[model samples]
Each structure stands twice: as C-alpha cells, then as structure tokens.
Target: MQRYFVAPAQISGHTAVLEGDDARHLAQVMRARPGDKFIVCDGSGREALAKVVTVDKDIVRAEIVEERFAESEMAWRVTVAQSLPKGDKLETVIQKGTEAGAAVFLPFLSQRTVVQYDERKEAKRVERWRRIAKEAAEQSHRGVVPEVMAVSSWKSLIGRFAEYDLVLLCYEEEGRAGNGLRRVLTEFAAKQAEGGKPRILIVVGPEGGFDEREAEAAAAAGAKPIGLGKRILRTETAALYALACIAYASGELGGD
Candidate 1:
C-alpha cells in the first residue's frame, strides 16, 4: 500500500484530511479515487489504514479503518552526526542513514571540511537533506521521518554530546584493538538485556576527516573513538556503514 505522512492537526477522530503537496500527489499524480485504501502516518508513530472518502483538488479525506502503532521504527534510537562532505555525498548519507534506522541526522562543519556553507546556503541545504530523509523514510516503510537538523559546527556538537547514553566516534587514527566499532558493539550489547531503551550518537567526519585536536576534543566529551575496520572508507560511506553496523548490533535485523 502507498504510504503518506500527515500532520497531527489534520487528523481528527477516525478521519484524516490531507492538504497541500500530499493532496496534490494523491488527487492528481496518483489519481487516487474514493474507496481506495492507503497507509497514513501521523509522524507521531501512529499509522492508520485509511480508505479514501473524498478526493478533491485542494484536499483529500480518508476514513481510518484501523489504527496501530508503527513497527518500522527501531527499538534503539540512533542519531548520526556527520561532518559536511564535498559534492552531493550528503544526499546519499541522508537516504541510507534513514534506511539504516537513524532517528535523527545532524550535519556538522568540522575543521578539515572542504565544503563551506554560509547561513543562507546552510538553511537551503538542510531543507534539501530533510526532503531526502523523508523520501527515504517512505521508501523504507519507516513509521516516522527521521529529522535532519540545521548545520552546526563541530564544537557545538561536542558540547551537546552529554545527551546521549552512548556516543561512538569513528576516527581513522584509532586502531582495531581498543577502539574498533565491533568490539564496542559487543561490549554494549553485553551490558544490558531488557526493557530500557538505548540512545546512541554516531559521529562521522568529513572527506578530509578530523584533525588531532578535534578528535581529542570529541574524546574528552565522552565519545569513544572507534575504528571502522582495516580499510578506510569515504565520509558518506563511513556513516552509512556505521549505521548498518548499529542496526545489526541492536538486533533490528532478524537473529536466531
């Protein structure tokens, strides 16, 4: 079934009214008609099995047939704090990161970042990335669209690191023995086995990667510097790889 996201205000009782771009997509693009059924998520983790009641130019109305909690969200909350890379690599990061079950995407500017974004450009870039996330969420059958935060500096990100229960920093300088990501995941999994939710923050650097001072600063802020593996990957690749590893480690993927 086709999935659409609607705002909470538009949903009242067992009826939902979709407006703006979504309405256009349903009425004109998809040519949806009355009696057709689709899934509608309220972005608050509630999904309704809706049957189209009316299809108008400016509004699309659907009656909820059934409502249930969205199962597409991961049990663990994972946020990716990625330093801006050159070219359009950030778009790929946004798409794959959402599929890998990231709860939020944070784009940061690090010291070694070659691409620069001023205030105006930063706003536009963030909007574009957020759209990428939304499309990815829909494609991946996600319950809620992952949030893409406004671009920030590395300094500011580190300062806010205290909010997460676990923060993993993929630094190339770190070797496999003490700082490998797999080892960290193993240890983290062993630490707990029950109801409490895990909140994680994964940090990935730019194309040029981070300098020594920045790495040290992140370490001081309680982020564990972990190695991705023997082979080095691009900035965008690294973030996606880390997110995949996280999902697997968190048991989001099936296991015996």
Candidate 2:
C-alpha cells in the first residue's frame, strides 16, 4: 500500500487528513478516490491503515480501518554527526543514513571542513536536507523520518557527547590508539545491554579528514576512535557504512 506521513493533529478519532501538498498529490496526481486504501504514518512510530472517504481540491480525508505499531524502526537509535562535506554530499549522507536506520543527523564543521557557513542560506540548506530525509524514510518504509539539525561547530559536538550512550569517531588512523568498529560495537552491545533506548553518535570527518586537534578533542570527549577498514572512504560513504553495520550488529539487518 502507498504510504504518506500526516501531522499528528491531522488524525483525530478514526479519520486522517492530508492537506496542502499531500492533498494535491492524492487528488490530482494519484487520482485517489473513495474506498482506496493507503498507509498513513504519524511520523512518531504509529501508523493507520486508512481508506479514503473524501477527496477534494484542498484535502483528502481517510477513515482508519486499523492502527499499526511501527516495528520497522531499529531496536536502538543511531545518530550520525557528519562533518559538512562539499557540494551535495551532505544530502547523500542524510538520505542513505535515514534508510539505514539513523534516528538523527548532525552536520558540523571541524577544523578540516571545507564548506564555510552562510547564515543567509543555512535555513534553506537544512530544509533541503530534511526533505531528503523524509523522502528517504518513506522510500525505506521507516517508522519516522530522521531529523537533520542545522550546522554546528566542533565545540557543540564535544558538548553533546554526554547525551549518547555510545559515541564513535570514524577515523582512519589505524596506528593510533583505537579499536576496530566490530570489536567496539560488540563490546558495547555486551556491556551496555541494559542501557535503555540506546543513543549512539557516529561522527565522520570531511574529505580532508579530521585535523589533529579535532581527533584529540573527540577522544577526550569519550568517543572511541574506530576504523571502518584499511581502505579510505569518502565522508558520505563512511556515514552510511557505520549506520549499516550498527543495524546488523543490533539484529535489525538480519535475524540473530
């Protein structure tokens, strides 16, 4: 069935309303009619199996036949704190990361970041990223769309580490004091098994990689420096790689 996310307030009692753009898409684009069934997600993990009851120029109303619990979400939440890469690379990170079970996205600037901040364009860029995440979530059948926060600084990254149950830095310096991602994740899974609602933050560096100071600060903030593998990866690739691996480790990718 087709799925559309509706605002929580739009759903009251057994009726769901799709307004504005969504309504136009249903009425004009999809040519939806009464009695057609579609899935409606509240974007907070609850969904309704609804049958269209009314379709007008400005709105589409559906009656809920059944309510659903969102089981597609991973057992734990994963957040990607990706350093702003050049061009549209950040959008790629948000899109694929959402599909791979990321709960949130954090775009930050590190010492090695190449993209300079533009206050005038920040809101627009963030909005684009969020739209990408929402579309990706729909495509991937995710329970909720991952949120993309506005650009932040290195200090903000450090200050937010304490908010997560496990924090990892995707670094390629194999010779440095570090553990492989597999080992680190395994240990965390075993040791922190009882940690309710696990929140993990995986930070990835930009194309030039993390400067010495950024790496040092990450370690001091209690983020384990972990390697993806021997080969170097682009910043966007690393973010998706980390999230995909976490999903498997937590049994979301496959049955244990």
Candidate 3:
C-alpha cells in the first residue's frame, strides 16, 4: 500500500486528513477516490490503515481502518553528521540514508569543507533536505521520517557528542591503519547489550576529508575513530556505507 506521512494533528479519533502535496498526489497522481485504501503515518511513528472517504484538490480525508506496526525501523538510532559536500550530494545522502534507516542527518562545516556557507539560503536548503528525507521515508515504508538538521560548524557538531551513546568518526587514516567499523560496532553492541536502544552518530568529512586537527578534536570529544575499510570513500558515500553496515549489524538487514 502507498504510504503518506502527516502531522499528528491531522489525525483525530478515527479520521486522517492529508493536505498539501500529499492531497494533490492522491487526487491527481494516484487518481484515488472514496474507498481507496492506503497507509498513513503521523510522522511520530504512529501509523494506521486508512480508507479514503473524500478527496479534493487541496485535501483528502480518510477513515482509519486498523492501527498497524511496520517494524521497519532499525534497532539502533543512527545519525549521520555529514560535512557539507559540493553540489546536491547532501540530497543523495539524505534520500538514501533515510532508506537505510538513518534516524537523523546533521550537515556540518569542517575545516576542509569547500562549499561556502550562505546564511541567506540556509533555511531553504535545510527545508529541501527535510523534504527529501520525508519522501524517502514514505517510499521506504519507514515508521518515522528522518530529521535533517540545519548545518552546523565543526565546533558545534563536536559539542553535541554527549547526545549520542556512540560516535564513530569516519577517518581514512583509521582505514589505512586497518581498524574497521565492524570491530568497533561489535564492541559497542556487546557493551550496550543490556541497555535500551543505543543512539549512534557517524561523522563523515567533506571532499578534502578531515584534517588531522579536526579528527583529533572529534576523537577528544568521545568520538571513536573507525574505518569503513582499506578503500577510501567519497564524502557522500561514507555516511550511507556506515549506515548500511550498522543496520546489517543490528539485525535491521535480516542478519543473525
């Protein structure tokens, strides 16, 4: 069934109201009418099977049929702190990362980051990234949409280290040294086995990658330096790669 996410307020009692783009998509693109059924999520992890009762150009109202759980989310909450890469690479990361079960995306500015920060366009850019995340979440049948946070400075990013249970710094130097992500994640899994769901932050640098000082600063902030493998990955590829491995390790990918 097609899935759509709406604000919690949009769902009341046994009714769901889908407005804006979703409404148009259903009314025009899907050619949905009364009795058409679909899944609707409240963006807060709550979802229900709904049957459309009415449809208009600006809105679509549906009656909730049954509340259901997809269990499509990962066991671990993974946040990707990605340095702003050039062009629309961040869009790719947000889209694919959401599908891979990333819980959040943090675009930060590293020392080697070449893209100039434009304060005037920051809000718009962040909004676009969030839209990408939402669409990807819906298409991937995710329980909740991944958050795309506003861009932050390197210092600001490091300061939030305490917010996560584990912070993995994707450093090529560590990759060359042969220390791998699997080993680090395995140790972390064992350590947190008895605890509740753990939150993980994977920090990936920009095109030029993190300089020695930036890597050292991240490590000092309790972020463990881990390698993706011997092979180097681009800035955009690192976060997605890390998310996939984490998902597979946590059994979200059907591993034993």
Candidate 4:
C-alpha cells in the first residue's frame, strides 16, 4: 500500500487532508482520484487506512475507513550521534539510519572531523537530511519519520548523555578500556529481561577518527567504548552496522 505522512492536525473527525507537496504527488504523480485507497501516517506511530473522497488543486480529502497501530518500531529506541562525515556520506547516514530504527540523528563536529558547518550551512544541511530521512522512512514502511537535528559540537552532544539509559561509543580503543560492545549489550540485556524500555545512544566518529582526549571525555561522560571488529570501518558504515546489530540483538529483527 502507498503511504504518506501528514501532521496530526490534518487528521480530524473522519477526514485526512493532504496538502502541499503531498497533494501534488497524489493528484499528478500518483494519479490518484476519489475512491482510491491509501495509508496515511501521522508520524506519531499510527496508521490510518483511508480512501480519497475528494481531490482539488491543493488539497485531497481522504475518509478514514479504519485506524490501527502501525508496524512494530523497535524494542529499543536508538539515537545515532555521528560526527559529520564528508560530502554525500551524511545523506547515506540519514537514509540508512532511519531504516535501521533510529529515532533521531545528531550530526556533530568532532576534533578530527573534516566537515564544518556554520549556522547558514547548518540550516541547509538539516533540511536536506530531514528530507532524506522522510523519504527513507516511507520507502521502508516506517510508522514514524525519524528527525534530523541541526549540526552540533561534540561537547554539546556529550552534555546530553544523561538523557539516555545507555551510551555506546564505537571506538578502536575498547581493548584498553576493559569493556566492549558485546559486554555492554550483555549487561543491558540482563537488565531489560526484568522490565522497562531500553534507550541506547550510539556515538560514531568521523573519517579521521576520534582524538584520544575526546574519546576519554566521552568515556568520562559514561559512554562505554565498543570495538566494531579488527577491520576498521568507514565513518558512514559504522553507524549503520551498529544499528543493524542493535536491532537484531534486541529481538526486533527475528532470529533462529
């Protein structure tokens, strides 16, 4: 089924109104008309089964036939805080991260990061990443569209560590720290077996990798360093790999 997202305000009573670019897509691109059925997601984890009742130049009215809980999101809410990578790599991160069940994306500048964003460029970057996330969510049949926040600095991201239950830092230095991702996940799983939701914050570094002092600072902030493997993965590849593993390990993805 075709899926579209709209604000909750657009869905009132039995009608779901499609406005702006969505309206144009339905009217022209999709060639939709009255009586055609489509699924409208309000980005709040709800899916409404609707059929078009009326179509106009700027708005399409859809009648809600049924409403149900959307597809399963994830047992754990993972937020990926990545140090900005070069060029189109950030776009790839946004798209794949959304598909991997990331609730939100934080693009930050680290000491070794090659990419820099000023206020003006930051606004444009956020806009671009948000669009990428939206389209990816739709393509993957995600119930909610993940958000892409404005660019931030590593120090600012570290300060927000208290908001999450567990913070995992992907680093090659985990061998020296006496802690690894497997151990961290094992402990977290033991806790979750009892009760409550798991909220994990994953921090991935840039192409040049994290500086030693920066890694220590993140550790002091309570983020455990975890090794990906012996082979070094690129900045963009690490976050997606981590999120995929997290989903599978958390039982969100079925296993034998």
Candidate 5:
C-alpha cells in the first residue's frame, strides 16, 4: 500500500487530510477515490491505516482505520554526518540513507572539502534534501521521515559530538591500520542490549576524505576513528557502509 506523511495537525478524530504534493499524488497519480486504502504517518513515528473518503484537486481526506506498529525503523538511531561532496552526491546519500533507516542527515564542511558554501542558496538546497528524504522514507515504508540538517562547519560538527552515544569517524587511515568497524559496532550493540536506545553518529569526510588533523581532532572530541575495511571507499559510500554494519549489529538485518 502507498504511504503518506502528514503533519500532526492534519490528523484529528480518526480523520487525515493530505494536502500539497501528497494530495495531488494521491488524487491524480494514484487515481485514488473513496474507499481507497493506504497508510498514513504523522511524521512523529505514528502511523495508521486510512481509507480515503474524499479526493479533490488539492486535498485527499481519509478516515483512520487503525493505528499501525512500524517495525521498519532501526532500533539504533543513526545520524549520517556527511561532508558536502561535489555535485549531486549528497542527494543520493540522503535518498538511499533514508531507505536504509538513517534517522538524520547532517552535511558539514571538512578541511579537504572542495565545494564552496553558498549562504544565499543554502535554504533551497536544504529544502531539496529534506524533500528527497521524505519521498524516500515514504517509499521505504518508514513511519518517520529523516531530517536533513543545514550544512555546518568542521568545528561546528565536532562540537556536536556529545549529542551522540557513539560517533564513528570514517577514516581511511584507520582502515589501513586494520581498525575495523565491526568491533566498534559490536561494542555498541552490547551497550544497547543493556538498556535504553542509543544514538549513533557516522561522520564521513568529503571527496578527499578527512585530513590527518581532522581525524585527530575528531578522536580527541570522543569520536571513535573506525575503518570500513582495507579497501578505500568514496566519502559518499562510507556512511552507507557504516549504517549497514550498524543495522546488522543492532539486529535490524535479522541478526541475533
């Protein structure tokens, strides 16, 4: 069934009103009408089975049938702190990362980052990224859409380290040294099993990867420098690799 995410206010007393693009998609693209069944999420992790009652040009009203328990989300909340790569690579990361259960996408500037930051266009860019995340979340059957954060500087990114239970810095140097990601994730999994949900931050550098000084600074700030593997991965690939490993370790991938 198709899924639509709406604001909390859009749902009231067993009724859901999908407006804007979602409404158009349902009415025109899906050719939805009265009695059409679909899933509705409130963007706060709450989802319900809803049956369409009305379809208009810019609105689609539905009655909530029953609340649904979404097991699609990962038990561990993983945030991808990706350095801004050149071109449209960040879009790919946000789209695929959301499907893979990433909770948030944070783009930051690193020492070797080549893309120039344009304050004038930042809002538009961020908005586009968020849209990509929402669409991907809906398609992936996620109860909540992943947030796409505004770009931050390297210093700003490191300062937020305390916000996460575990911060994995994807450094190629560590990969060459044989410090693998699996061991760190295993430790994190054990901690999660003890009690309480833990938040993880996976930091990947720009196309050039992180400079030695940046890696050292991150490690000093409590971020664990871990390697994806012996083979080097592009900056965009690192976060996805780490997220997959995390999902597997947290049993989201059917692991014990």
Candidate 6:
C-alpha cells in the first residue's frame, strides 16, 4: 500500500486532507482517484486506512477508514551522536540509521571534523536531512520519524550525557574485548532493571577518530568508552554498527 505522512490538522473526525506535496503526489504522481485506498501516518505513530473522496489539483481529501497505533518504533530509545562527516555522508547516516530503529540523531563537531557547515545554508541542509529521515521512516514502516537535530559543539555533545540511562562511546584506543558491547549492555540492563526502560546514547567520532583528551572528558561525564573491535570503521559505519548491535542484543531482531 502507498504510504504518506499527514499533518495533525489535515486529519479530523475520520477525514483527512492531504494538500500541497502530498496532493500533487496523489493526483499527478500516483494518479489516485475516489475510492482508492492507502495508508497515512500522522508522524507521531498514529495511522489510518484512508479512502480517497476527492482528488483536486492542490488538495486530496480522503476519509479515514480505520485508525490504530503503529508498532514499528523501537522497544528502547537509542540516540546516535555522530560526528559531522564530509560530503553527503550525513544523509546516508540519517537514512540508514532511521531504518535501524534509532530514536534520534545528533550531529556534532569534533577535533578531526574538517567540513564546516555554512550558517547561511544550515536551514536548507537541516531541511534536506529531515526530508530524508521522513522518507526512510515511511519506507521502513516506522511509526515515528526520528528527529534530526541541529549540529552541536563538542562541549554541548558531552554535556548531554546525563540525559541517558546508559552512554557508550566508541574509542579506538581501547584494546579489542571479546563480546564487549553485548556484555556491557547486558550488565547495564540488569543493574537498571528496577528503573524504567533504558535510554541509550551511542556516540561515534569523525573520520580522524576522537582525540585522547575528548575521550577522557566524555568518560568523566558518565560515558563509558568501549571498543568496536580491533578493525577500524569509518565515521559513518561506526554509528550503524553500534545501532545494529544494540537491536540484535535487545531482541528487536525477533530472536528469543
């Protein structure tokens, strides 16, 4: 079924009005008509089966047939604090990271970061990244569209460590420990079992990796520096790897 996101105001009392871009896509792109059925999500995990009532040039009206809660969000919230990579790499991160069940994305600057974000174009860049996240979320059948936050400074990144129940920082300086992630995560969960669900923060550095001083500062601020194995990964790959490992260990992969 074709799926699109609808604004909260666009839907009311079993009726949904998809206008502007969605309207154009339905009329000109999908060529939908009255009685045609598709799925629409409100971007906050609410979804409905809607049937087209009218398809005008700039507005597409559909009556919602059914409404239910979406089940595609992760069992545990995982935030990825990724260092800004050069070129269009951040787009790839948001796209794939959303598919992997990340709850939020934070782009941060590190000592090794070389590409500078031009303030004049920051709005446009952030808009593009959010759009990529929306499309990826829809395609992945996700209930929620992961938020893409503005770029942060190194201090700001570390300062937010207290927000999560567990914080893991990928450090190349550490020796390879067998099954380190799984063991640490398991232990953390057991210790915090009395509390509510875990809110995890996984931080990955830029291409040149984290400076020793930065890693030390992060450790001091409640983040545990862990190794992603002996082999080195690119800045982009590190975030994906950590997210995948977390999902598998948490049984989000459907294993018993």
* TM-score between candidate 6 and the true structure: 0.94
lDDT of each: 0.87, 0.87, 0.91, 0.87, 0.91, 0.87
lDDT of 2: 0.87
Better of 1 and 6 by TM-score: 1
Q: How many backbone clashes does candidate 3 have?
A: 0
Q: Model 6, residue 228: displacement in angstroms?
A: 1.6
Q: How does each model score on TM-score?
A: 0.96, 0.95, 0.97, 0.94, 0.97, 0.94
lDDT at residue 185 of model 3 (Cα atoms): 84
What lDDT is reached at residue 122 by model 5?
100
Clashing residue pairs in candidate 5, if any?
none
Tell me the TM-score of model 1.
0.96
Weakest lDDT window of 10 consecutive positions for candidate 3: 247-256
lDDT of 4 by residue, 56-162 (tens): 98899999999988875878889999998998998998898898889989988999988656677777778988989988888889999998888888889999999
lDDT of 5 by residue, 9-28 (tens): 99898899999899999999
Estimate candidate 5's alpha-carbon lDDT, on a 0 to 1 scale. Answer: 0.91
Tens digit of per-residue lDDT, candidate 3, span 83-152 = 9999999999999999889999999999999998999999999999999999999999999999989899
Residue 244 lDDT in model 1? Answer: 80
Which 10-residue window of candidate 1 scores lowest in summed lDDT?
Answer: 174-183
RMSD to the hidden true structure, all candidates: 1.4, 1.6, 1.1, 1.8, 1.0, 1.7
lDDT tens per residue, model 1, 1-256: 7888878887789998889888898889889999998888888788889999999998999998998988888768989998988899999999988888889999889998898678868778888898888878877889999999998888899998999989998898885354688888878977866866788999999888789899899999999998998888999899888888877887779893
lDDT of 2 by residue, 1-256 (tens): 6788878998899999999987897789889999998888989999989999999999998999999888888777988999989999998888888888899999999888888778899999999999899888888888798888988889988999999999999988942444579898888777655545688999999999988778888899898889898778988899888887888787666775
